[model samples]
Target: MREILVRNTDLSEATPILAVTEASLAEVLAGLGQSAGNWCAVNDFSGRPSSCLLIPSAEGSGATVLFGVEETGLPHPFALGAIVGSLPKGDYSLADGFPDPEQAALGFALSAYRFEQYVTPSRKIRRLGVGKDVDLDRIGIVLDGVKLARDLINTPANDLGPEELAAAVAALFEKHGGAGRVVVGEDLLDENFPMVHAVGRASSRAPRIADFTWGEASNPKVTLVGKGVIFDTGGLNLKPGSSMSLMKKDMGGSANVLGLASMIMAAKLPVRLRVIVPCVENAVSGNAFRPGDILSSRKGLSVEIGNTDAEGRLILGDALALADEESPDLMIDMATLTGAARVALGPDLPPYYTHDEGLAEDIAVMAEAAADPLWRLPLWQPYMKYLDSKVADINHINTSGAGFAGSITAALFLSRFVENTESWIHFDIFGWTPADKPGKPAGGEAQGIRCLFDLISERYSSAQ
Candidate 1:
């Protein structure tokens, strides 16, 4: 992981060096004289993603750093990734003022992350020798949580079924000393998680509800529910081949929730944490639930299955209902629920829905601070009637045929089950990156985890 901290001293113990753009390379080096070493003259040549050089102590008293960007503005995230890995293992401090240390820290930490769970020979990484000001330990903790999420989402569906997902949750509980419970198979029917069972009945892996409790019970309660559809074959209402290609990441919501939970537990926040994952695999079997089927939910609401492909909302409804029963101080749910959300806001930004205006504003603040961007989408009350059904209490799919505001409708469906909660927020995330970016590669990404972690930290820190 990367370490970043505010430096207070101007250390004169190091070599003198100079960093210059291609246009000013000669003039900068000539003016600095022999006190700067031959290698001290680093270039800011365009086209370099992140490149740097280390000048020897012979001709210099202090090192000069040059960044390779077209404009003289805030440095890009991960700009120091390649340099951090290659710098000699020695104590080094930032010489100049940095406007954004968090972004720089994230870049360094994420660069060290490698998914080697199944590797024959584990990869080795060197410790980043940073100055005392840098809190590298905190950076490592955050990266570890992110890597956990990515590894879970990237695993094949065969190896990561509902049972396996539950087991993973159990591992977290055992590691953090939290209490975990899993209700599977017929137990779902007995416990009145009928909708969870119905949607999962088509698959060989039984549907289950994985719950975990942590922190002081007397503290303010926070409930997090994530849709853990391991693989979505679209059940009876199937998806096209391209859509099925990325269905393995349908469980990204679960991975993200677990990641955020890990951060809270590791940081020892002063809030009671409860994570509820409705784990299932939406597959097609002889017993698959079809369109027009009416399934009873944990909240006693009967939902008409207008479309089986819209199964994420069905399972989440039951989990949210159970979360609402606790009447937690705050309730948050995340899912890769709709393509329309991505089409409207692009893959880089996820749309979030919340009833509490202040809570949403706070989340936006934290999102900006953490650099894990998110956007707000309306939970329009006008569209509530779109989900109305004649035979059942509500329709699972919108009947308007044109499918307007897909993300809002999904959030509206979830809203029905969370009436009593003081604050409720829902996130529709892409979960997977189509291409690579600094720190975040083109694979399973931990969306919304950092922002939520920041929010929790701020809230509990204030209480302390």
Candidate 2:
């Protein structure tokens, strides 16, 4: 992932990839000499959003890259990422003109990402010289975290089922001096993760929950819960071809949480970190739990399965209940839980639900700083009536068949399982970038990880 960035290169021999904004275009062109200036005029390169113009050098083998951007005045933070796809195989340096070189460098790395696990990676030689001011090690950690989430989400479901995902989590924690165990198959029921077993028992792969912790015991306790629906076939209510096409990414929440966890541990943050992920595949079988089934939860709430497709919340209900037992300093859960969230905010901005106003405010601050889009949706206590059921403590989805306020209602459903924590936040993330943007490609994207990392670090920093 850091292949695009380099620390050392011969500047005199290497071609410079200049990020030219409208404000600096004239001076930049003048410095490039008359021949290159004439090339720009004929090409009509006026420094538009993603425009690029290559100026040949005295040596025909090399060329200077003039990448267009609006810089600080630009609407998108990663507009400079345009050069990643446009540049040819060569050694290049981002010479100047970006207000924030670190963000500009990060943008280059983001656009350089490609999910090439199934095929051979590109062997073309392309290296960038990130200036001295940028922290190369920090950027590398962030890139690796993003790559981990994207790779897990992009892999096919057959290769990434519940058992495999549990193994991945165990290996990750072990790598960072943390230890964890997974209660697999029928043992989940024995471990009181009944909802997890109920959702995954239909599949051949045994379902499991990965519970782990790291950092000093006396430090601030931070717990993270991610819904790991490896593949959601909507259970017996089976979705249409289009709806099920991307079900492999249903476990994206777990993938993203793991990415954030990787950053925290790699940085050696001074905090006690706990991660709880219930990995399950919502498949179909003759013995699969039916629509009317009332599932027992770890929290002791009987959840009536109003719709089999609403399996994420049921499993999360159990997982969140388990996490809240410790009443950690802060608890956060992420899930690709509802289509209603997508309809309301689209794919770019995930809606977060949190009752703690101070935490919400910090999230807002970090989100903008990280250029990771996140929005807040209310708990709307009045909507709790929509989840009421005569047969059980609560229904796992909107009780009304018409499906009004679906995202808010899904959040309200999870709220019931979390009561002990002083501050808890829920992220209903889309997790996939539907279309390619400046720094974001169209495949599995990591949402909220960057912003949340910054938030957590600030909250528990040694300086604090």
Candidate 3:
């Protein structure tokens, strides 16, 4: 939350970011005079969509940025994204040529993010001067939330274990003047978070649940449940080294939940917001929960552990059941749970599951508007047969094994725990950027939360 997006600036002194399309390119070069035209030709700057040309200022040192916009995707929101990381360290302002400046500014702030804790980054501070059309307050708040999630997800498990994850939730609630606490260690079993305790029992780090609430009690209720597996060693059924490399990001769901909560509370949205995070580390030890162990849930459902690696759902099941007890107006759970979700929609577009058609349509519309990507996969009750267990009420993982619609089955498993909530959405997010993209860098990412935030804001805007 360091003030990265600068609001006020000496407009005359700032470097101008002149956005151009092929249609506008000629007029721009002509307006700059023959000398500027010569510069463009000599430099081979044709103003293609991805191409950027920097023209040295005749009166001063730093250059004016000439950015190309794709004509096909008119008003591409993130067109200014590349400038964040590419532009030289200085004050920059977007010229009036671009449409959707609000979204463009938001994209710029998001693209500006860097996880620089472990090592000093080479780049210096670069600030954007977004004029009156953009809401700097909203941009700053959303960016802070997104930054929190990315930072938490980027941090390794060695520094951010189960205890640390709980602490982070406590810190968020504290910042927003909300009251909350965590139940940790053997106390979790007594508190009825048996599955949570079972998952983290093997690790030295204690398993726990973090619950916090904000806003007026009488307002519309929105409860968020996030899967907080601080690190996944996959318990007894360990993952190969390649798969284990990103286990630190398993808590991304919790990270995103806290991030979204931060935005809601900071904006002072008129809704009762309750966040529940089941924090655990699925580690290997003599005492780890084994396959075929029928673990009891907070909802009174019995879950037969099909694989120790499918530990995220176990933790989420307890949390979802706990959240559903009150039957909040909306209940949403986020998890970096399934590789199948990544396979189905790739890394960028996370798949969401919702039984309610109206809610699904609203989410889809808002996701598009917010520029936060999501694809809907059915709750498909017919596929619920895949989860049946002879020994227990349900099996935690699909008995059909991998590629048997693993993401769908995982959502189906979570759905069984949630009986009371009519409006519940499940987000199976990968939560990592495999490579660098414009607004998203190569590391931990914040997914689905922004779209959900917009949806919530609209639903409860008039409420107190």
Top-scoring candidate (lDDT): 2
Between prediction 1 and prediction 3, the one with superior TM-score is 3
TM-score of each: 0.87, 0.97, 0.97
- Cα lDDT, model 3, residue 273: 95
Clashing pairs in 1: 2-109, 15-61, 15-62, 16-60, 16-61, 16-62, 35-59
**lDDT at 319, model 1:** 95
lDDT of 3 by residue, 135-240 (tens): 8888778888899999999999999998899999998898889988899899998989899989989998888999999988998899999999999988899999
Measured with C-alpha atoms, the lDDT of residue 50 in candidate 2 is 62
Q: Candidate 3: deviation at residue 25, Å?
A: 1.3
User: Candidate 1's residue-wise lDDT over 383-422, tens digit each?
Assistant: 9988999999999877888889889999999999997898
lDDT of 2 by residue, 127-194 (tens): 77767888888888888889899999999998998988988898899999998888899898888999
Please report how far candidate 2 places residue 165 from its true position, in Å: 0.4
Question: Model 2 off-target regions past 4 Å?
Answer: 8-12, 71-75, 462-464
- In terms of TM-score, how similar is model 1 to the real structure? 0.87
